[model samples]
Target: MKFSACLAALFGAVFVFLPAAAAPVDAGHARVELISERDAALPGETVYAALKMDLDDGWHVYWLNAGDAGLPPQVIAQPSSDIKAGAIGDIVWPLPHLLPVVEGEIMDYGYNHQVVFPFPITIPEDAMGPVTLDVVADYLICEDTCVPEQARVKLKLETDQAEANIREGELIGKWIAKSHVPFPGEARVLKKDLNWSLSLRLDGGFGKVRSIRFFPFGHDILHPAAQPVELGRHGATVSLSAADMTDVSKPLDGVVVIEQEDGARTGYEISAVEGPPLPDTSGLGPVGGVGIQVAAWKLILLAILGGLILNLMPCVLPVLSMKAFGMVSAVSSGHAGEVRRHGIWYTAGVLVSFGVLAAIIVALRAATGPITLGFQLQNAPVVAILALVMFAVGLWLMGMFELGTSLQNLGSGLADRDGDAGAFFTGVLAAVVGSPCVGPFLGAALGAVMGHSAPVVFTFFLAMGFGLALPFLVLSFVPNLYKLLPRPGKWMDTLKQFFAFPMFLTAAWLAKVLGDLAGSGAVAWTAAGAVAIAFAAWLWQREARLPRILAAVTLALTLFGVTERAMAPAPAIGASSAYAAKYEAEPWSASQVQSLIAEGRPIFIDFTASWCATCQVNKATTLKSKAVHDFFAANDVAFLVADFTRKDPAIAAELARHQRAGVPMYLWYPAGSDEPQVLPEILNQGLVTSLPVNP
Candidate 1:
């Protein structure tokens, strides 16, 4: 018996000396282990433990606050019946690295290669010795794509006062030491306009710092935007753009990371006050890392190109048709000086209109929220006025009445030779009506600088307006192109009459737009006002003082009545898409998108508005086709429409993120990927079908 007792004691001592560890559970992309620092712990003692994840190369897992996408690693823990529940405190999250999930597109905060999460196991003071804990860890592992994985492991701790090994305890200490320390000095966060800056005043100076970055503990931070870092003596500020952060009333929580010249980095955790005088950031030159500055020149060029494309839009096409006739007439009239002068006047008109529009948009955005392109047309009054102008122009072209002055020349067959005012007004109308067609190239450009300075906004807008007038301005200057026009003859009358139909068509289209904007009541009122206008026109042709006076009164009454009725605000409603019903597309919602993505389903989002002619054309063709529908059905792709027909700040913010001015943004979120793929503004069935659903 004595010999057996001695043998049992020896075996117990040997087992206690061995490190307590759970077997590593394979999780496809990673291996997870629940390990303890020592084999045992006495009553009132705390044993160090960690959940270790050994990730495959190039793969990563998210931190508590994932920057743009993915969720943090979570442990599935049940109450330990054997151990006190309060003994286990909240999980400690170590500082994670900021990863560029997609370079220059998406960024996230996460851990890569290997990460250790410390879990301090406290032994209850009341006679407890051995404790068993179950840990089932779930995490999203990502590289080019994301995969949700899980690993389950059981860790056992024996109770003993004397343990031979303390190596695992020392190792856990090192991992815990790697966590971001609390900021030693004052911290502040300031939100100026749409831009946000988080400043840190550290105890240690910034002299040896190589680069600095702020990893915000929230996803509202615009990850892809340029974060210009400004560093001072012991201070640094990271400037960034944020969306949907209506309340900056709470203190900002984030980790501030700084790299050294030796490639090593340190992180400091902090809570920042909302209001601030701001720390000094003028001590040193710009640091080299992370965000790349957006190019203003590139945006201006893109805006010009996009504006040039607007000439092809239906709303602007009829106006261009009239200008084509004007150019031909100017050439036939043989006025070289006047031709060049008209071109200059027309360009001046376009630039002036664009400037006014830019100023209005800037003001509205400052007062309200995110905005760009076609917002003017949201006012039913504007649509009604445009309709009235088109109808009046159609009547004039049909030989209703002709005026001899500069004002009349503005409507004559030849804009350039008729009068400079005519050419200028023509340019103004072209720009005003063309504002709705925010096509590609311009989307990204405007998006890059939308929340910027007033001067910058005007510059890009003027460049775009210049592009819109480029075609006609060139014809006005180039004598050779003028020669391409047929000589003025009796056919000019017939051609002029034919052009009236297109003007009428534009008028009808504007009426339809008004109906959509303010309901059918606006359309009925506009139609009634049109009849009054036509009667007034006929009365004016009678050439009597009383008749002219009556005509003027009727016209004024019609205009006043239309303006009053059209300006009435419409009831709020969801954006309806004709194509959505036909294609079985769902209305877009951020929560739905996240849910579908988590389910590993492919999603295709169409950012469209009814006022957008290009968006309607695409829907009438590519998105409406049976082939596109079949592809979606076959691949289990969820079709969603982000309708921008009405004012929606959420949609505006989303569009701004993609650098788009307005609707017709096609976003393809493939299965197993969080980052969406931006398809061209114009989509084809073949391209839609060819998108890969897997990595």
Candidate 2:
């Protein structure tokens, strides 16, 4: 990719030089004429060339940098022998208007009428008679898209004892001063765990300081859009995150351009002097490395164990209590044998639920391929739906309705009319609810499984399912355990009512997750849904058909609101671009890559994600390394970052091309290569430097 970018740049540069039709002089606008005051100036005396621009209404041109994207006029002079040319200063720029572009923020400079660029000529100390000089001016004129304009203006100068007026010189001096950007003092780099801190002293008082923008010469060394945390007093101490810090050892070199609130601009070319290496505080105490690793492992293990432990979770506890109540009712009704049958049915329900989940996961895995390559089940819509489902279940559990009938009917048709199918579904629901809370050992096991082959992944999930279902399975097989339970009584009703709190809590959690996925509107919808559910349950219990209809209508409205909220546009990820116009991103293809390489342009490829934690982590870390940046700058590698963070079909196709289903994938194409070289999950400075480039 780097090589391809370099080639693209080369091609662009070459294309810039190709002969083309000269932009016609706008006869409607002001015209400029170049003439020397004297044929030649005497040695040590100044000679002058007059540049006059014709103008139309509301026309102007500008100085270099053009504030943003418009180019400044260039004057190249060719002098004959017996003549010496002094410094050729920049042309004066009138105040320019800001032009907005489609893609990024860029300012352009040009005049509708005409402008003049004057330069002084110094004669040599040696005697000189007549001198001839030819000059050419290349400039860019723009109304919307810029057009390069060039013209040749020839003149002859003879030795003259008298000097030209110095008023033009004074004007040029003033413009030069205005164009100059003041330098700020140097700064020191302070190293932290995952960020770099810079403490710099400004020459002027803090009162003069307004907004500061740091432009790192190396593109990938830092996130360009990350807002710097500024601590200002006598001096400013800025902390920059290194989540995208690529090379730690590499020095930071950049320009800190500070724009005052008053519109005054000053700049500092800062080289971040390295601070002392951070202390290896790894073994400080129980709270250090050992603890962190243990905690991480504990979380992973807990996830695995939680799957097994979920059978005992509060959600399942209520169902079990209800089942016990039913069993007691049966017993008193002279159906004691039904207890054994019910237990077996519940066990079957649990296993079948596990098997169903396993099958779904397996099917998804097969459909999507490797998880490591970018498989994410929780896309925006999916997450919203999952949250909604959980919230609905929570409402049901909270006695929003007599969910018993619906719950029983859900899996009651399996095998016999046994209530065991409900138990199985409960098991499945438990596992689903357990997903967000990754318990100990489960994280490591899950991480491992995600990168594993299909069989291994399936086996791991199977083990997790078994673990989750184990408790229910064991209890179902143990009739002695049922015998130990207290006799069914009024206490069971109180317990059933008490179990509603857990369901309410679960509902609250699910609502919160929904809010995160779909925004505050989702939260509002869920809250409304909860109220409706409660009312619906009350109406159902009252056996009032009219109230039940109203409750159903309310529930329908709430669901509709949730669905609408889920479909709303999300906020964009980063700061918008700063360009005169934004270009539509062309699909990356081998041919395009080859073309870019041939052009000698640099490319930046971003492999990103909306759900991937690691992809974001890399963007914050190694991809932003200083060494990687320096390599790119030195090679002029076009920086193209492929963003796979969202559901971009182009990115998906690219991933498919690379045999990947997910992101954190990288590919570098050197100049002339039809294919791109794959990069590793863990980016390194060496890997960046090792990228092939064409001269």
RMSD in order of candidates: 10.5, 23.6
Model 1: residue 78 alpha-carbon error in angstroms: 25
Q: lDDT per model, in order?
A: 0.74, 0.49
> Model 2 residue 245 lDDT?
43
On residues 97-134, what C-alpha lDDT tens digit does candidate 1 reach at each position?
Answer: 87876544567888998898887767667755666767
Give candidate 1's error at residue 48 in angstroms.
Answer: 22
The alpha-carbon lDDT assigned to residue 563 of candidate 1 equals 86
Flag regions of model 1 displaced more than 4 Å. 1-292, 365-369, 405-418, 451-453, 575-579
Give residue 224's lDDT in candidate 1 (0 to 100).
56
- Model 2: per-residue lDDT, tens digit, 383-487? 445455554554544456665554455675433343444454555555554433333344334433433334554555556666665554555456676566577
The alpha-carbon deviation from the true structure for residue 75 of candidate 1, after best TM-score superposition, in angstroms, is 22
TM-score of every candidate relative to the true structure? 0.62, 0.37
Model 2, which residues run further than 4 Å from truth?
Answer: 1-306, 309-356, 359-418, 451-456, 542-557, 570-695
lDDT of 2: 0.49
